[model samples]
Target: MMKKTISLLLMLCVIRSFSQDTTQQIMPGRQNAIHQQDKPYVILISADGFRSDFAKKYQAKNLIALGEQGVVADYMQPSFPSLTFPNHYTIVTGLYPAHHGLVDNSFYDRKRQQTYGMQDKKMVADPYWYGGTPLWVLAEQQQMIAASFYWVASEAPIQQLPPTYHYFYNEKISIDQRIETVKEWLALPRDKRPHFISFYFPEVDHAAHSFGPDSKETAEAVQFVDESIGKLQKVAAASGLPVNFVFVADHGMAKVDQQNTIPYPTIDTALFTINSGSAVLQLYAKDKNSILPFYENLKKNAVDYDVYLKSTMPASLHYSTDDDRYNRIGDIILLARLPKVFNRGGRPTGPGKHGFDPHYPDMRASFQAWGPAFKKGLQIQGFENIHVYPLIAEILGLQYDATKIDGKLETLKKIINTK
Candidate 1:
């Protein structure tokens, strides 16, 4: 009994050590410069895997109401190979995944001889893995205060600068508590309050992956997010700040064929290293001389997928060798057809998946904006997600080098209320 008790205690200690941290992290001695004290507030919220049509299909009443008060896009086009980390980073940096160096959720960087996966906390937090000046980094560079409740790469001190007020990503904090924290930030003194804040929700993505995008569980998760946003808005209003809210999703979820999953194509392991995804697979050649032969073989045997050399990828994707600034993209790319996904080693797979080409309707993501800075009762055509960085930057009056980022402010400038 004593031995068992000691083992249980040890397990409890381990769990505590690894458990999510709910503490608010703040950078000391930081304040909004006097010039930024009067700037408008922008709260950027991302609901991962929230599809463009989910509000209407799942009857997200609160979101519908919010849309009626602001601008709604028909859909938001995610960058190529739509995935969470890549798209989220793309939205903030206004650069495509390849240009931003996040190329995929899981990718091997030949230069660093390192692999970056979303689940690897150390890799995810390493600033070396990221590129491009994120909006928060831009804001802080200009002495504007920024904060993040949760966002991709928010924990990383990119450019050696993190948001003035932030929290490490964790789900242990209840929705109410999260909203309350936002309220607290807004209630801070003029110079200490963050003018730009980012918030994120992972519930919808989690449910969709586990129970399929159309399942009741996914709908429930959507509703929860919808209600949570409503609460956040109410609290912000109570703070009496003109908070502009921009809601988006990294990518949409698709109900995929869980049974009879696609098998990994046979490859000579000696010559290649593989990074596999549900809808995409990348093979890095050990020798440049071996690439063409292996690629030709894969192309000939490719079934239910399309294979391409890095240079031959469609120009629209902006993911070809010309766009691979960091050399993070694989030498050979394999894109899985819809409803089919690669399941290596016959591992258990989820019913819902993404990371497909963004051109597919099922891969389009959500976008909505409301509050004082937006034109009311407006609906617009779909735009690429990169434009979002400029939108938020414009709203907060944050200056950025237009030449350094891909987003053009003109793409979203018309939606801002000039009057």
Candidate 2:
């Protein structure tokens, strides 16, 4: 009896481990349509917190070489309040953060009367919180197979469909193993292969957040991503398919005044609920009548930051009341000026942070693409990240209603080789 009990406990441990790290979540009974088998392949890669100048600054040889072989943009401008989840989802959906409903990394939804946070696993995977048609969803709706190693909203069933091939977000898998899986996907039969794939790397972002962006640790992390991309490209080339690569970053990083962090302003709990971040803060008023009084008081005493109501926000940001399609933008918003951030918990703040105004030079993102379909040795001017969606859709011959999306095909059409 003792021996049997011990065996049962070991088996239970194995089951729990498998449940936590289920590497692949595939939607069976799905295959690429016959016409899609001949379509071009695009592997969209996002290296988090990889600043616009990181490649040249860190001497990322592989990415530099890839840019020379194909097309390179001066920089990619992320949407306003450039947080990770919002900008990433914007890139895939071709909508501004406000229009797509992911207003911030963590935000309150008035309709649900609930908070959506990046750390909340249930909220992260819940489809109801996400809006806009993600690239994977768009492809699958058209009968094309799509895969994702990991991308924001990829695990969620947006439009009642997740990617045909995807994985729950986890860090346990080695980079080598992940690359091997991509190779395996490409090697599958024509109908079973995925034409559009998304891959993400979080090492640079992690290192930069813990250590300053200029720290040696952050530099090493950049090199790691550079080397990993080099390996992925080499393995992908061996697949004998006309695979295209679009390398991008969600947003850049900046060093802040960690020693002199700003503490959250005092407010009555009964009147308002607060969602705060290092770079931005939002106050949701429980009573609409109480908003102006608090806004006026905060504005009078505000320091090292700027405050704005949804109706009064700068139009250039595309993040005002008119843009808040899902009503997730706070009743009152606060944005910290550069070199300073808010610390609501009074904890030691990290030196490196993002979620700043996108117009700042440090907030710019990186964009590079190389493949058979692109014009070789061409360098282009900087453009908004939203334009990327239409570019990818055009290359893959995927149809989308241009009227609904903010991206315009003409913005990036010049980069592709039509002849």
Candidate 3:
């Protein structure tokens, strides 16, 4: 009873503090609104599964030049539950997965009594699953054009508004086509072009999964992506338009040995729904009270991973949420201890996986931006990925509903030029 009381108190305190904060009003340092004719343009791209070191390790020329010419972070750390959909949204919305109600790339929403997983197209497009407003949504509200190649929550009309040039998520679109489309968007008259745009390339991530992160195939994919960057720049220069470019990755990858799969055949699978993430696992008990007893026994047989209850999750991850508002978060989360695979559910054991502890060095994402808005040759150490939202907002002078967000404008302002 005492422990329960303490946990409840802590949760309430967190809620109360968030409610009373400064997020209810407009931010103070917003720059002057963009003039209709010379509106600043920002193109943000995600190189799926691209690790931070691939630039230096593989000598990726265009990427290295972008870093040298503008602001580049040593790395951009991903939010907790470092899966693709969640972290991608976090980068645009400045909210952690828990706060945004995307507790997992796949999970059951207790409030709606429905399951939301990325695999189901209807569920993926369901607006209810996406709680926060992404950059594209807000961009439309401001009467500025925004386009998306493929972005989470972009297909749906979030807050009853979608990007002006949005399309359904299609990962198979060739990289050359993706580049050409964005160039075509920019080549349009200034008023017709998107003030903010996004592109997603899945080849690096796909190749890393099919082949280990260290394999020659993954290297080839990395090289191809670098060449594609050159193509994008060539098209942009040809169009005679001034643009800002920001490149990032959802999260890094880690190799999961297929030969050593840890299938937990002994546990009674009936007690809970085990959502296997390959590198991580989430457990939702049929009876909430049964969790404590199950954990006791489960700990006795535990190997190669650490288990965490909702209330006991690391404070740094910022993953705890008010269950009354949404209960999609797991009752128990299992994080694999480095380079281990706990594949009890017989899921596909791809050579590479993410969704581990965000603090893990291997799970760190990448961030680099080059344009007139940024300071030339500015390089800084790694920072959290959530800060990207405010940086985008600042560059475009966007006004959002958030009075307070996880992303701090001040933290990113150092990279901006004052004059």
Candidate 4:
């Protein structure tokens, strides 16, 4: 009995020592590992309304060359309505239309009962006006900086710091001038360089809206944006600060058949307004109750459009929630499945029109990335706008809340050499 007790005590002591050592080994700092990784400077470029087919159809040598040097997605499916403001916001926030609070290009706030559009800079620029944290805000928080040539939320005063620098909306400005301004910023000293940068070209989207998607004008505009990307890349190279450019579009477009086109019913006092996308229509009603009748009427009557409440919106849209900061989406959402016109501003005299349909091939946007951090000759499956947000955050080496976002940075793991 004495020998057994001694053995037991020895074993107990050994076990206690092992446990203590293990406990010390895994103390707080052990689990609190800081993953410090080398990050790359990121530049995001948007060719408004440019579609995936443009890559195969148009001879965009610069874009194609960029793809050859990096990765190209089969398509970058946009969020709901595949419209401009919402989709662009999605790209930066990594959330669906509903979550990001930019449900559409134009929407009516039920609380304030006010209409909103990109042109409404005062409201749009308010950080409180948005829901998710854009990469710019994330970069600022991480002590890294960001810049923008002409992006939707770039000019907005968000958090304590917005983009380190940005150009307010200037419709009359030329795309080249925008590129030049970006170049000037890129020339800043290495320590002063922004970790992330974004540029938007609305010319192609404008041209597509003015002249149908198939028009020679639209094709020419694609080439123009491609050349613009080329020039920007050249400037970055000249600056000796290698930059990776991620080229994307807010949404794609499809030509509306005149015979098939149906105009939306005119409202009396305009209970709601709309923000046009390549194929989505985000409607906002002044009275939430009015939305039900309006939505039911569209579904029962307008068989051409796919309508849903913001809550009922499809998960695939990457915009499947309502944001407190941006809850202005109409009670009933109307998405045109067929190529048609909503004609909010009275039959826009344009050969082209978006804000209609997405599932269709013509409505799928494009994506391309090239630079030191990108893999050459790589191709990826088409993804959503939200994916770009995480990828941008990853490239800039900034931490972000992926939980709030519908996107993930793992999407770029194959393209970037983390090892």
What are the RMSDs of all candidates, in order? 4.1, 4.4, 10.6, 17.9
Put down candidate 4 lDDT per residue, 1-419, tens digits, no spaces: 99999998986775444323211011011110123213567888888889888866878888888798889999988776667887888888888767767767776666666666676545666665577888877876676657776788766677756777766655656667777777777775655556688888887888887788878888898888888888988888897765888889988877776554556655534576564543456666656668778777777777566778877877655444444346666555667665565554454446666654456677799988888878889989987677888777776667776677888877766777564
Model 1 spans with C-alpha error above 4 angstroms: 1-19
Please say which candidate is ahead in TM-score: 1 or 4.
Answer: 1
At residue 323, candidate 4 shows an lDDT of 48
Q: Write the per-residue lDDT of candidate 3 for residues 1-419, one digit (tens) a residue.
A: 99999998986775454334322111122222346447677889899999888777778889998789898899999998888988999898988888777777888777786777787665666688887778987777677778887788876678977777766665445677678788878876766677788888888899988997888888988888899887987877777766888999999988876877766525456778767577667777778878898777767777887777877778888875453136777787777777787776576777888888888888888899988888999889999998899899888878875565678887888998786
Model 2 C-alpha lDDT per residue in residues 194-283, reported as the tens digit of each score? 999999999999999999889999999999999999998997899989999999999999999998888998888899999969888999
Q: How close is candidate 3 to the true structure, as a TM-score?
A: 0.88
**Which residues of candidate 4, in runs, are more than 4 Å off?**
1-39, 266-298, 307-312, 318-326, 344-349
Can you write out model 1's per-residue Cα lDDT over 120-173, one digit (the tens) per residue?
Answer: 665677799889999999999999989998999998889989999887667889
The candidate 2 region of ten consecutive residues with least summed lDDT is 14-23
Q: Which scores better on TM-score, 1 or 3?
A: 1
Cα lDDT of model 3 overall? 0.78
